[model samples]
Target chain A: MFEAYLTLMVFGVVSVGFAVASLIGAWLLRPRVPDPIKATTYECGVEAVGSTEIKTNFRFYVVALLFVIFDVEALFVIPWAVSAKTMDIGFVVGEMMVFLAVLFAGLMYAWKKGALVWD
Target chain B: MSETNRENVKNSGEDSQGSAQAPVPGVAKPSIPAAAHAKPAAAAARPAAKPAAPAEVLPEPRLNNGRGRLLGSARLWPTEVWPNPWARPSFVRGAYWLAGIVAGVLLLGWSVGEISVWANLAYDWAMNLLRLRQVPELWAQGAWSAVKVVVVFHLVALAPLFLVWWERKISAHMQSRLGPMYVGGFHGWAQTIADGIKLMLKEDVSPRAADAWIHLLAPIVAAAPAVLAFAPVYFGSGLTAADIDIGVLYIFAVSGMTVIGIVMAGWGSGNKFSLLGGLRAGAQLVSYELPRTFSVIPVILLVGSLNLTAINDFQSGYWLGFIPRWFIFYPVMGQIAFVIFLIASVAETNRIPFDIPEAESELVAGFHTEYSGMKFSLFFFAEYAYVFLSSALVATFFLGGGNAPLPFLRIWPSWLWFFAKTGLIAFCFLWFRWTFPRFRVDRLMDFNWKFLLPWSFANIAFGAVYLFL
Candidate 1:
């Protein structure tokens, strides 16, 4: 298991090195020709208007919140799914059904609260 | 500027002279009057911009010919460009085509046979030659690990080049056009190489208002996770770079980091389109990821291990002497889970129908819009690499990674089988890109939440009951 992780670590270092190397290669090969017009933010030829960091729809925030809830739910689900195969089938089924039922109820609540509905 | 002025004068003189005559017999009149009027107004506004007209009256019939038709259609095609000779077959071309096919088959056969085994032996011999007497075991192990890392890197780097080229060819053929016909010897094999060189040579642009550090780091972040995700993927029996116990979990957790890079690109660019693209990517990837993760649960339950090799091993035996026990073949629930996994994979990779984040018509290239040169190519590389990784996972989980269909036919190497299965899955991805239209943002969210999410949940429930039975 530790060896497996070591492989991942080596791959990570190598990948970062490769990315940096490619970037450096591009920097060396590319021409540096900067102009005010060229460096300006592209907005389909029109001059950009207003700030980009405006308030977005609350719907996106709601999605983020839902994702957090469900992601945590998944964190619980995987181990159960794996170990459940070796446990008593009836008991495992009953327990998972209960867990899923509560999760389903939460989804329903969010749906009713208009959190899932994108305006 | 002076050249454009002269061209404008030439265009206006031709347009006015052409419009003064009777309308063409069958052609539809040009739709926009503003375009017709603007040309003459420019001519009137700047008298010096106009060229002196020769007394010679060129035949007005030139406007009604093929050139006129091309202009009227509002499409750009240079009439002077020579038609590709490959479109027509000569004896030499046919012979070359036949030779290429034969060579490809021979190469495939060689790779599936002694070539790979010999390559491994050669590497081991080289390592043995370099081994120190003091710590031979440690030295050998370190060298082997280095070799493994190099192989993984090669897979991560080179696979995308082939996949990108294959995607272009596949998508082009699907749409009835020739893709990359001229670059390399046969069917533009070196097109991606040329593109890579061009990308490196082009000016690397960053917006003046953009955050320089985050903008530069975003591509690295985006690309690194894709490379890391390959760690747990098994290429063949005993051929994994890292055979971790929590292989599935590791892959999902790492691939999830790609969203951070996209979000950083969006936020760092200081462009509303980039931010919107990034937010949409985050939301879409997050939403679809649930179903993608859940879809794998059924496979895990059936296989009884989180290790990818274990899952692959579980699918190896025949069910009834003829049918292979692939997870996808497990009655009803397995099929449901596979279908859900495939759809979610499509959305996760931001392909057609779920490509809202970078919808060219809407977002103007999305999160990486401000990026150019190598920075832009990094995102392109990461996307194709993800496609490969996703297809490899699909093959491993569902289609039986590196497992032959028939027990009697086991001559080919296991890695070849794995790649063949992956190629088929990757082809399906390309096919879907060419076949489907982009989904609307609301509709995309609805399909995931309303349709795929519920189905994935149901698939898990069905798997539980099926396993119990």
Candidate 2:
């Protein structure tokens, strides 16, 4: 029963190993010619002219906030979706509808507050 | 010539600094002071200048259909179609008809026998000849698992090589040109192979300002999940790497990790374009994930299992003796789910028109702007691997996975059917890349939250109604 998960672990290890091995192989075969000019950050041939850590737009934060709220809600609903077929249709559907309606109301609230808008 | 190039670079650098200090039309006022922009090593030699004021309102993208509210129904903006000689040549038309006829005849011929039965017999014979029947079950299982790991790893690694070539050829043909016609002969079938070799031999460069540890790890983060996500996928009737019960959930959770890799690539590079691309990807992938997950609720409800094999089995039979009972065939509800899922999947893979994260004209190569050589190729490998993964899931969730559409078509092995459906859907991904223009960043987000999210939620309600009916 647990062996499938072990297989998954093996797959994970092998996959990461493939990446690391490829890098190692490339390091072995590739030539290293270091130049100060080559090490500079690319700004489409112009000299890069500022710190890379500029202030980001505030709208991305709002989107992230909205995503967390809905993603958690979806996660809660998945188990119900899986088990609903065996349960009473009316009871399950009614229960899920109320849950979804409340979340839908939350989504609407976010919409009205302009949290969903990107500049 | 060298002096002229240096003079050009110096002039452009000064010009860019000058523009940075000037109030550009339509750009929102920068919160940072003008002096902050000149903090770089080369730029510090220049004297500080006063900041510019907001000159003009940035022209709002015409994407919102001119409605005052940003939350209107997303519309397909007009596209400029160019006349292309190669688009529909006489030979191409004949080739399509000829291909269709050949497929029809093949399907007809295929109906006479089943290949899986023969495969099973051959497998048993091989095992008997090797005297492996007496082996312990655990050892056998371990060996089989090892074989599966190798096969899946190779599949993840090699699919991209073929897909990249296929996409290039497809896009080239769509634009009235031949792509890679010379490398390794036969319309450059081995073009990707040659490119792979070239990439491996190329020098890996890291920007002087880059976070060396994170830069090195980014490709692994981006790629490993793509390969691991394949563990739960069902390739055929009994072919799977792990066969986990929560297969659907597992794939979603693992593939979500790829975004982190992308963000790492963006941030670790220490380039503004890479950072912006990463941030955009982070937001865009997160936004679309909502709709993608919600769209699959109907199928999960119907199948009552997150296990992919069970879901595939649920869609195996026909309704009314002819029409297949695949989830996509369900009235109204399935179509909505399928369309939403397809759209969201495209966005998830970061292809055009949703490819704002790496919008080449705007963001350079996006988060990967600083990556080079084998490290760069890893990102490409992960991307094309994702393209294959999403298409496979689309086939599994909407189309009947490993199930023949007609009773007569059941003679072909289920794995063949599975791959055939996956390939057809993969072609659509390539087709979409060449067909549509990139979306504006704002409208791209709006399409998800306002449009796709609402529809996907409404779709679940529709699925409930369809359930008892």
Candidate 3:
């Protein structure tokens, strides 16, 4: 297990290095023709107005919140999923079914409360 | 000043061109009068602009979109582009191509004998020449790891060059136009190479208001995660970079880091559109990620292992003498899981019909709006790499990694089978781009949370029931 992870570490370094190398190569080759006009933010050729740090829709936050809940649910589910076939089948199935039922109820509650409504 | 004027002319011309292309016979005849009136109005509005007479007289070629009478004007199918056997009803051309491909593969298998024999022998000979038994065991292992790293790095670096050109050609053919016919002789094979050179030679620009450090780091952060995720992906028998026990989870965890890079690019740009695009990407990716993970649970449950190699080994052999025992062959549960995974994968890659994050018309190239030249290309490469990664995952998880579909086809090398499956699925990714319309942002979120998520959950339950019974 550690051996595989050791290889993965090497791969990680190489992947990041490749990106940095390409950027360095581009830096070497690319022409530097700096212009004040080019430096302004792109807003359809017009003078860019207003701050980008303004408030956004709350729907995004709600989705993010829902994602957190489901994602943690996945953490538990994966271990059980991998071991389910080897364990006593009926008991394993029963346990997962009940777990899913509670999650399903949560999903339904979120749905009914209109957290899923996009408009 | 000259550059700004030229841009004005170009934008005006494009707006007029939209009206010019609108009068395509059948769909909306009401637009004909408006289109006809708009031409003179456009010319009158801009006297300095070029003469509209030449563009008006040149008749656009009407497309013949296969069998469907209604679909002829839609331009959804590539009926007119390819040399089809049936001239009139061209919609069934896809079916013929599918049959031809299957037949060609069977013939090749019959003629080539056993490819695995030659491949394995070649591998063994190379290993023997290395004399690894004489060296320290750790050093020999390091050497092997280095080789895998080099190959995967180059593959990640270079695949986008091919995929970008392939996408251009695919999109062009579907729209009944020739894409890059002249560059580098026959069929523009070296078009992307020329493009890379051009992009490298161009000036790199960062907006004055942008966060300098974040803007600089964003592309590197974005590009690296996709490359790192390729470590555990099995290419063939003994072809994996690292045969980790939790290969599937490793890929998911690593690739998820891309969202931060995107968000950084968005926020760092100091542009509202980029920020909006970044927020959408964050919400959309996180929402769809749930379904993508859940869809693969059934596969894990049935196989009883998180290791992709183990999954591949289990999928070998026949179910009823002829049928392969691939996870995709496991009744309704399998089909549902495969489809959910496929859709989620498409969304994850930011492809249409789920590409609102970078909706060009709405967001002006989205999160990368402030990026230019080589920096822009890194983001471009990251997108294509993700496309390749998702297709490979699809091949591994459902289509059985490197396993052959039929008994006789087993003669071919497993690496060949792995790549063949990956290529087919990647083609579907390209096909869907031109075939479907973009989803509205709201509907995109709703579909994931409401439709795909629930079905994926139910499918897991069904998978358990099937396994127990």
Best by DockQ: 3
- For each candidate, C-alpha RMSD in Å? 8.7, 15.7, 10.1
lDDT of 2 by residue, B125-149 (tens): 7556445568765565565567679
Colliding pairs, model 1: none
Tens digits of per-residue lDDT, candidate 1, B54-79, equal 23323433344644322443322322
- All candidates: TM-score: 0.82, 0.80, 0.81
Question: Which lDDT tens digits does candidate 3 get at residues B96-195?
Answer: 7669978888677557545545545765775676674576666666766786688877887777888889899999988977688667865687999999
| TM-scores computed on chain B for all candidates | 0.78, 0.75, 0.76
After superposing candidate 2, which stretches have Cα over 4 Å from the reference?
Answer: B1-139
Q: What TM-score quantifies how close candidate 3 is to the native fold?
A: 0.81
Give interface RMSD, every candidate, in order. 1.1, 1.0, 1.0
In terms of lDDT, the poorest run of 10 residues in model 2 chain B is: B71-80
- Model-by-model DockQ, in order: 0.65, 0.55, 0.70
Candidate 1: regions farther than 4 A off: B1-132, B136-140
Ranking by DockQ: 3, 1, 2
RMSD in angstroms between candidate 2 and the native structure over all alpha carbons: 15.7
Model 3, C-alpha of A12: deviation from truth (Å): 0.5
